[model samples]
Target chain A: MKLSRAVVIVSTCCLLAAAARADEAPLEGQVLVLSAASTTDAVDALRAAFVKTHPQVTVDAGFAASSALAQQIAAGAPADVYLSANERWADFLDEKGLVARRRDLLSNRLVVVVADDSKLEVKRPADLEQQGIDHVALADPTSVPAGIYARQALAELGLWQDLEAKVVSAADVRQAMQLVVSGAAEAAIVYASDAATSDRVRVAVELDESLSEPIRYPVVLLNRGAERPAAVAFYDYLLSAEAADVFRRYGFLVMADDHPAADAVPVAAAQRWWGLSRDEWLALRLSFQVGLCAVVASLPVAIAAGYVLARWQSRAKWVLELVVNLPLVLPPVVTGLLLLFVFSPKGPIGGALAGTLGIEIVFTWLGAAIASAVVSFPLMVRAIRLAFQAVDPRLEMVARSLGAGRADAFFSVTLPLARSGVLAGCVLAFARSLGEFGATIMVAGNIVGETQTIPLAIFSAGNRPGFEAEVWRLASISIVLAALALVASEWLERRHATREST
Target chain B: MNRLSFRCAHRFAGGFALDAAFETDAQVTALFGPSGSGKTSILYMIAGLLRPREGAIALGKQIWLDTRRGIDTRPERRRVGFVLQDHLLFPHLSVERNLTYGLRRRRGENSAIEASRVIEVLELGDLLARYPRNLSGGEKQRVALGRSLLSGPQLLLMDEPLAALDAPLKDRVLSYLERVVEEWHVPTIYVSHNASEVRRLAERVIMLERGRVVHSGSADELLLEGYSPSGDWEA
Candidate 1:
């Protein structure tokens, strides 16, 4: 079905090009091509080579996550061409007639990767089924193309049904690789291109190419009526022997050059908030709940740590502060692994709770919240610490003089004075939780509508060929959410300030 | 009648020591001294806010502090009122709330001063609902006085209470103090550098210099005519 769609797309692109060439000659002028950061290296090399050969035209390239780039395009941003990591996005533009023509540039393979120095042996793809080796990282299959391929591969192997309890879905293929490379997970199924970017990890088993749809990278010229000659030229240059060699070096499988279909999305597709499907939205809602829970749960601890670090006269205060902020410095995957090591069923806390209290955290939403909280905890403490420090000690002293005891003084004076900082910390925690990827994936095992957040949704969306639009949609929503959170924090801080003064 | 007596010895580093011993049966006894003369320190020790190395403080038949037995009490349990040099009024609470705090904490006590009587005694009726930020220095000090009185303390310790106010404002508060001491007859140890206050308010004067008591006598005798450097009773 996908092959037939590609054929139709290629024929449509060819027809469009022929008609354009007959009417207005070949496109000409300076070109701007925006692409996903994953393709940054490939696109950069291609741009340099293209610009060197054609001195009259210059190619200005912009790189971001595919969803971000696609949103910029849909917003009618000044971009001549957009080359995405998957065909779904290009197909979206084609359906909207936003693209003059779409073309399949390259193909990618999905494979299971592990840390090069990993102790667990995975001689066969089915070895991922081992029970003790619980953590299996993958991109969210709904939104990210890599995640889709990984899920498809899992389903094909009949592993998806049994592996549901073990699967940890990262926000993106990069994060999935991080999970395995950091020893947080036993294995991660990612694109070969992604695995090539890291030295710490190596591909363990190549996913059966026939099991899942081919990972096709498609390029679309977005300026249809006012065709960007430079953009079209850059697109053509991608098909040249030189650019193809660079793409090949990046582990992309070169496909026969072909035009793209005019109508890319079939009927009966679910509408999304950016790239997230209904299930992914449920994941997002769950992510929000988890993030909020993490922040709220950690708030008292953060505030206490902030107070002690800010005001306590103990000799060990500095050491405590450093310990509190350690999560900020360590990589998130490391934090996740640390959490897993301590919270897994056999881990101390895990064993104690499960054995004594029967409260299991492994592969649970609560576990995911804990992972996100650990990573985001430092942010809350830092923010709250600053807030606590800014409080005038005189206020507490005055409360004491007015017959209030220490705790009463704190509640009456110190807490109110630091309200803005607390609010700012909570906002930061919320935003960080919404976007949390690595730690959450490791602890929660991306069960759809269970632990996945907006970032995970976008990451999963990026894996499918035709899900680029969905990824872009999710990306747009995430950006909006993050922006809204920041603005709200600033507003809250100002409001608190005014109230305190009044 | 409440009578407070302190025979206290406190040591500072490098051999400096504050050796003070005095007894006050009067309604107001002034500890007159310049800054760093251990006047505030004595008040703090008397209020049980500070622990002196060697001291004995007795209020009437009650032995509040005794170095020999090591029976010191925490500030909250001590029945003493302390007004600091600056009015340390609770900024968040209204004047009435601040005045009522200690009273409420000592809940179910029959001897506790009624909140209404405190408001009337300190002339804090109009300022009751107002927050500390809205109150002037004189007003705050009066409220502080009211709050202290409401706690039903045996003795009141005023540590340079008018130091932060200007002369005119100080006079206004000092006049109010005279009225309160005369009408309520609250036993008091008032610390101040102004000699005239010693003459007008305190019948007995405890003079301190460099953390040591130099003299103790009637206020009139210390500020005696021809005894001053100018040999004149200016006031």
Candidate 2:
């Protein structure tokens, strides 16, 4: 009977050990985390820390304005976890039945900031009303959560009515802080964390928490991520003691009751192809694809415009010239915004196109291509026009007299002669498209793989504190691409010159 | 034989004016004039390259242009071959491609002026693979003439075709022109400021002076009135 009891105890011990083994199975698969722009540094640090312990898991992150991230999630972006700077967007997702679980993750304080060398002293919200503070920058008060908090603080202090006239609205908190850093604004109202990012700007006043609603960041795991074990592990790790410490270091007030921190393990440097990570390679490849599509799509229209501008003699020619060249001189962002208006779902052309053909352009690669095409059009046309202008008009006339139609003459005679210029223009346009950022971000929304090009990737990398290496890498790639394009065009022009002089 | 009639009045932006009129059924008619006398302008209007402010141009029963009637046939539909003063050979095309360009565009089944025949008559066989940029001035003019001939035009307009060549090259190209005209008796209007070029090429001559038709007669009668071998008319 003692032997029987011993066997039974052994079986029990074996069962317990098997269960423990099952619990310790390594988490694998990818976790996509979409976070607020203000949380970029904290999130990057947390991701680095998390990946160290869960070495088999990959955590891909995207950071933008919370509203944009929420919209992306609503539009069916494959985001596993979303960390918004405010509860409103999280609640919006919950109402849409998109959120499976959520909790308040962190909080922040709003502050007034001024340039490091500024003579104006802004100790209180009322100080912003001084004549010395001619301009004050803030994130868009109507939409961005940081700006809304700043607006509430100003209203609570009874300074909103007087200081509203001097306010310059920026797209995001970092941009608002950048204005003060650049001395473009006498002061700016931004998050304390963002203000801490730049040594060029100094925090003048931290608005009392009582002045505005408590600024809470809510983290949510979407329904799409509920079944993914790696996503759940990453989401749970975000609330652990290690992540809380990261948040605290980045000036955020950690609100989660953190669990025990994971073991600190060193992560191996990710494998690189030609000194670029997988994501950076994806961005580089997308840039070339988009640049090529832009050039190919715009070539026929550009050629026609160039031909008309070169040969047509009319009093109204200047009008056509101005319209063709407007994009070259306009702020690329303004050009992007204009394209957004015409290509948005509610727009006339966009609505009709979607209704009839089911073609959605906004936030897609095609939208990116269109933006690049528009931004690079003037350069293409100018080069092509110069090329066409250099061709003798008599050759076309001779073709015409030889029973060739206008189009036939152009294709056979004029276009062939201007081929080098057209090639140069194409290269120039492609290079310009590769560097197109302002319009691409506005229209394409910086979605990874779908629209994030090299320039956009660089912009994102530049915003995050720990990604300086990534920023330099992407910037160097851009320079290399542009240099190669310039070399190709120079070679073409030289060949054309030699052919002509021969 | 089809009769060709032309009348036009045009004013240049620089205030120069052209008012000329003539009708001919000859195989070769020359618009003889000095520089700025609007010889090339008349050829351009006839070929539909330029529109006169007031004009009517016709070849036999075909009304190519009548401004008052609001009818102006496009240059391609007019079926008139034009060889410019610069021998405007398509610089990007080889000699063979240039010669066949117009031949390929001919809408009619009129294969009377075959590409091989034109190539042989113009002696363009050796230069077929060479681009216009690689050809000499005289070679370019011959290729231009061959290209125009292969189009099977109802009429050919020669705008001082040898004007760009030096004297020796001009004589060689003029000989090629005579061979082309002899092989295919296409009705032609040749424009030249040089009296000798006109005398060599024209059966009938229409003299232009200060934008008006000063005289119209046989080439011998008009050119011999006051012409010199140096191509100047005695003032």
Candidate 3:
């Protein structure tokens, strides 16, 4: 008996010693872990714990919408492990035979959120239909996972019908949260994680779990990932009790092993606002503002240059024309890089502006305006120059003969005659400004609200996406806006011509 | 003493050189020439539209152009109204606006010539609201003469203002032009190849051929002398 007892103590001590050693030794090699954006905080905590036990291992965690990660993996992205926010996306990968192994990881709650100072009150899903709430922002239910959950919840609660008119959609849960922060809407429905991240909004209502679709995230291992020992180790570590605690700590309602077996619907949800998003709306507004300001800012200079090119007799006139047209000829990226070099903080002009004038253009809306103005300046000058050329010089001479000075002749006679061309020029410049991207991104730095015009916003939003539809929507809106401007100017030109003809 | 004295020498790109000098205080002096003569060049120089290679010009001692002394005034400030062969009414402006333009720039002096009187004399009363492009050639010429008259200019320069008109229209516009200068008492330099026009419009005449003044005398004497198309005479 004494000998058996001693043997048990030695084996137990050996097991304890082995566990201690594993805690001290860092894991070896690298692992590329992809996680749903909703669980980014939880995944980061999981990575921290994994690296602590296996200090030699480096985990690179890329967080995006779960559906996006699945699509990326299907498109041959080498993801080791995917912690998705929904079973549908994981099932999508599994159907492609890209998933080597998978299990349900975590679940999340859908909550309606409102600004802290909002006078609007809502305690239940039906409360969303209350009189005080005219606009309710949510993730695009057609594609975004949170939006799908919100839609399911609203449908089950029988409030979808009444709230349809009041609903405004966003690109994702985070953007839905932004609607409340921006005060563009009275309330929003987003994932609890997104609400937890923002301090400006508070949860107005917690959706009933039974009414919504089961919000379970399934973690999957891509086929390639299963072969990597470190990837498999990281995958195992995520499923451990330690990761569960992290998920729980961050407001994820952790669930058991099974998820819904319902086939993933690849079909996007029914159209809302013809598939417009808050990001797209903001982008449109920002684009027009930038284009208009750019045109207004550069018009005087463009007019002067155009007048000289049209009327002056100089050998260097062609050279001036060529110089003005250079931006149109050069690649936009080259223009962007050159502007970046000149306007960056360490650069000469940027430094002077910051130090002396307390003015900052780099990474600001003004910088975006400057970038677009430079890009579109040639178009404006060219149009106005052609207009000026078409004017009979005799008309100006007559004005001068009538005691009108140079400035007076231009303002009174020449400019009025060139009205259609001037308007056409402004439209062209404005359209160009709307599409300006490369230079604006370099100079304005694509800050979400301030410097992000439509193009830059499209790029930034496109970066964190399964948002192909959203991006295309934005692109089409911009095209429509530009087309409307063109049509309006053309109509005005025709009207002026008809009036002249009579 | 002559109220306007101008001396200018200019060379054309086609190698035609205009070396001319003349003085006139007549209420209307016509510069008579054939199509290629330098009548227009002389008028252009006095109006400061053309820079003479070397010259001096004065209107009642105002010293309009004295290149040697670097004293050249801009055309608008010179108070000289110029009417071109094309009438040169601003196509964008109505006849009324065209007339008001120079009147507006009277610069500290209220217009001495009334707009209504000038309009009526030129028969532009019917066309006041019409754009220059909308006016007939004769109507345009009427508006042009009226516009110049309203400016209250010290001198009026007309370069074939009746050249584009038919015989009857020319006679009508010529009558208006005559009345404007007589009424305003403005020193006028009228350019034309038509000897009859010179005789009817001018108190004195200077005939030019091949960029040189071939004759100058009273309108009847110059017309009687005739513009020698072959440049046979000297000033």
For residue B187, give model 2's deviation from the true position in Å: 1.3
Q: What lDDT is obtained when candidate 1 is compared to the true structure? A: 0.72
CA deviation > 4 Å runs, candidate 2: A1-34, A41-62, A67-83, A88-212, A218-274, B233-235
**Candidate 3 residue pairs in backbone clash:** A26-A54, A26-A55, A27-A54, A27-A55
Restricted to chain B, the TM-score per model reads 0.89, 0.96, 0.92
| lDDT of each residue in A63-141, candidate 2, tens digit only | 7888878886775455789999899989989999999999898888899989888888788778888888888898888
The superposed Cα distance between candidate 2 and the true structure at residue A53, in angstroms, equals 16
lDDT string for model 1 (A1-502, tens) is 3323533554465456335423542236556676754564567567778868787765656554465456545543346777787877677666766787777878877888888887778877889887658899887667666677788888988888888788897755666776776678888888777666556677788877898877788877776423665666677777787777777666677788343212211122343434445655676666666766777678779889888888887787879988888988888878877777787766789779878976657555677779878888898888888888877675565444444677876876687668777878888888888888877655554444444567766665554323546777777778888999899878866766665342
Evaluate every candidate with DockQ and list the scores: 0.11, 0.52, 0.33
Question: lDDT tens digits, residues B74-189, model 2?
Answer: 99998888988888888777888889899999988475898888888988899999988888888888888999999889899998888888999989988888887898899999
State which candidate, 2 or 3, has the greater TM-score: 2
Best of the two (2, 3) by DockQ: 2
Fnat, model by model in order, equals 0.10, 0.86, 0.67
Q: Sorted on DockQ, highest at the top, how do the candidates line up?
A: 2, 3, 1
Candidate 1's residue-wise lDDT over B1-235, tens digit each? 6677788898866676788888879878888876788998888787666688998988887787999998776555566777876667665567877787767666354554578876776778899889887878889888888887777666788887887888898888888888778766778888887777667889888888888888888888886733452221232
Candidates' C-alpha lDDT = 0.72, 0.83, 0.75
